[model samples]
Target chain A: MHPAPSVIIFTALSGLGFGLMAWLGFGLPAVSGWSAFTFFFVAYALAVGGLVASTFHLGNPKRAIKAFSQWRSSWLSREGVLAIVSLLVIAVYAIGVIFLNQRWQIAGWAGALLSLGTVFTTSMIYAQMKTVPRWNTPLTPVLFFLYALAGGALLAGQTGAAIMLLIVLCSVQVLAWVLGENSFARAGHTIETATGLGNLGRVRLLESPHSGPNYLLKEMVYIVGRKHAHKLRVIAIFLMGLVPVAILTLLPTNHYMAAIAVLSHMAGLFVSRWLFFAQAEHVVGLYYDKR
Target chain B: MTSLPQSTQKKLGLAIDLDTCVGCHACVISCKEWNTSNYGSPLSDMDAYGAEPSGTFLNRIHTYEAKTLERAAQVVHFPKSCLHCEDAPCVTVCPTGASYKRSEDGIVLVNEDDCMGCGLCAWACPYGAREMDVAEGVMKKCTLCVDRIYNENIPEEDRVPSCVRTCPAGARHFGDFADPDSNVSILSAERGGFALMAEQGTNPVNRYLPPRPKADISGSGQIGVPATALGEETGGAKGFLSWLDKALEKI
Candidate 1:
């Protein structure tokens, strides 16, 4: 599939934003009163901003409300509805934190659940496309959830508990990346079948339908050389996974280094997300005459 | 609220035979000829004389080799257009409701005037069947020659799609698939027709019959006749006769 930059940015940023929300909402109530307020405000802002950025993906942004009507069958609809619901829950939680002193605890718990729901919904948007076997696996949603939590924990206030959370999150991220890579390899066979070939044997392009380029070729046939893809994969695993974990575990307990690790993780995730789209060969790619 | 009876409905579809298909691409040409003049506006060719000339084609022939080992393999020509899937992802994803499936005949169609050219329907489709009409600012696809198929002025037997009629090898067949006794349904069953990308669960109405097997072309390795078959050389006369026989054998 051709990587839509808007969508790539949306998914990656939302994973971070929602992941941060999940960790903060779940952890804030345990923290001291003043510290809880500060964490909640920052996490909520990220989540809301990420959700707003996602709206730019729609071709006709005004008709986005229609997306909610097909939630019964369409994952995209469910995602939109769930995002709205999560936003509403966060709003109520913020109100409770500011004024509704009696319901603060109850609202915080709701906020935590809503944050997790947002992550699941976001993951399901890709996970439901069974045609793309790489995205269809149960691991896809699990990885998204893990990535969100990891990103969130990394961004949360740099306390001792926060450092421990970051370490655990990074471990899960590495595990998910390994599993995701395997899933992609398996998916290659299915994509070969989708092109009307009878077997998994090598299928090379002999001709292209268009002269210069067409929309289908531009969108589906994203060419990432094997060597470059390997290099990027290693960088993603190290910077996003190992480096963050190592900094949290081995480095001196300094807030600046922890924050820098978080920034590096985000940067690594941007590259990883680009690979995620670039490496995905849509079945339509077969028609473009370039394997 | 009122509901329509299901028994009155029909499922129309096309049955394509891969075995007899000659790969002449006549169906594609006929489809372009019919749809361009009849359906809506002409499928304009941007520049016939210029460096880049492009136009809308409702149908196209995609030739491929199915599991071959030879250098010049046997090719399977797939005449592709809209499958007019029962699920019709393109219809459901249309934000404007301009694209829809006919409840009566199961024909998926686009309303050119109502389309806003959002291109979401094209993205939703896995088959890449839909294409944007740049001149009209709307999406277009195979209508199954709706204008020609139902024309009252034409004779009943001749009222089928132009592609079906123009197919020289009789590879294309069109009919109502809802009826069990329909020609398309029967042919599909007998031939064990397969849907492209069945894993996608699009439930495409059009089906492609598998190509029939051909004889093996591998050569067998063997030597010439034995040396003992040659007569013995006794003397000058006999040797001369043997030489003569050898020359006759060579001839």
Candidate 2:
């Protein structure tokens, strides 16, 4: 893919925001008074910041009002609408936790569901593009949701709160990675099918009309070597998954180690997100001159 | 607007015979000539006489040589353009509804006046059929000679697309795909026609028949060395020179 910065930032930042919300929604009930209020505020702020970052992706921000209109058919439009709805719900929950003691429980539950809904909408943006077999899978949404939880846990650790939550988040992250890796391989199979080529057969580019790189080739045919990709995948799994969980478990009392683990996890998720876009082989790649 | 009488409109399309296409680029030139003059916008040439010349052509022929020692080398000329898909991704993905499918004939078309130069439709299309007209700031593609085909001034026989009519080798055929008896449909059925990237599920209307084996050009099957010239030996240089002189005298 063309490495659309808007989409990349949106997915990554939103994952962190939603992940934090998921953790806070689940964690707030156990805490009391000032501690709970602080967690809720931080989580709400992250969600809002993520949403703000996503708006930068729009070509014409003025036309963003029209985005909510096409939710009936377009996943992109649905994502925009749902994301706004999620933000509103999160805001309500934050207010409830701060001022309305009796309604905090109900508002927190609503926020959690809305957070998941936002992640689902985000994943659907790419999943709806049936032409791109790599993104057209149920695993996409699942992976997005898990990444959010993983990111939130890492963030909580950095803030010197919720070591146990971090462990749970990292565990889910490992599961997500395993599932995503399997789905990623399956997606490659779909690309082969899209090009009408068998697994065993060699499909070489025999001819290309254009001498220089065209939009299709530049956008779809991203070339990453097997060794480099494999190494990155391992690093991503470790940094985004196991390492954070280990750090949170081993040094539960050490706030500094917890913070480093969280930062490393964020950096790792960024690499994971980059690999997600880079590793995907769109069916249009078959048309490229270089395979 | 006058409403036509209710009826089942047939979808017309082209079925190209790849086996017979000689890669002459006749169809490409003919399509360019017809569409440039009559379609939504002209396919302009950027630098006609300059060192680096480029232009928007509705149709293009790509030659592929499948290298295999067992079958020698075979050249497959693929004449590519708009397939006019039934479920065209470009049409549905267009935010402005500028790109649309014709209910009458399933032909995907763009309204130049409505197009916002967003280039989303171009991205949605996998075939790379759509090209932006830099001068007009609108997308241009093969209309399948829409103007020529529906022109009332032309005769019924001549109204069947300029590219099909101009093909010297009869490689291109245009007709209603809905009619089983249509020439295009019959040819497709007989030739085991295949749609390019059918898995994309755009349901492209156009089909291409695979190339046939080359039997006539390889000449007689002689393994290696040439056979002894008739029965005459003429072994020595003096005898060979005499035979050569005699052969030259006869010529």
Best by lDDT: 1
Model 2 docking grade:
incorrect
lDDT of 2 by residue, A39-107 (tens): 666666666676676666443344446545545554555677777777777667666655655346666
Q: What is the C-alpha RMSD of each candidate to the true structure, in Å?
A: 7.1, 7.2
| Candidate 1 wrong stretches, greater than 4 Å | A27-45, A99-103, A158-207, A250-255, A287-291, B1-9, B20-58, B70-72, B86-103, B108-126, B130-169, B199-201, B213-251
TM-scores for every candidate against the unseen true structure:
0.76, 0.73
Candidate 1 per-residue lDDT, tens place, B83-143, comes to 8888776766554456778878878888775565546566566666876666665677889
TM-score of chain B of 1: 0.82
Question: How good is model 1 by TM-score?
Answer: 0.76
Supply candidate 2's per-residue lDDT for B21.
Answer: 82
Docking class of 1: incorrect
Please report how far candidate 2 places residue A197 from its true position, in Å. 11
Model 2 chain B worst lDDT run, 10 consecutive residues: B1-10
lDDT of 1 by residue, A97-197 (tens): 55554345565567667778878977876665544455667877877877787778777744455456555655665565566566644655443455554
Kindly report which residue stretches of model 2 are placed more than 4 angstroms away from their true locations once superposed: A23-65, A99-107, A128-133, A156-204, A224-227, A252-259, B1-9, B24-60, B88-100, B109-170, B216-251
How big a share of the true inter-chain contacts is recovered in candidate 1?
A: 0.11
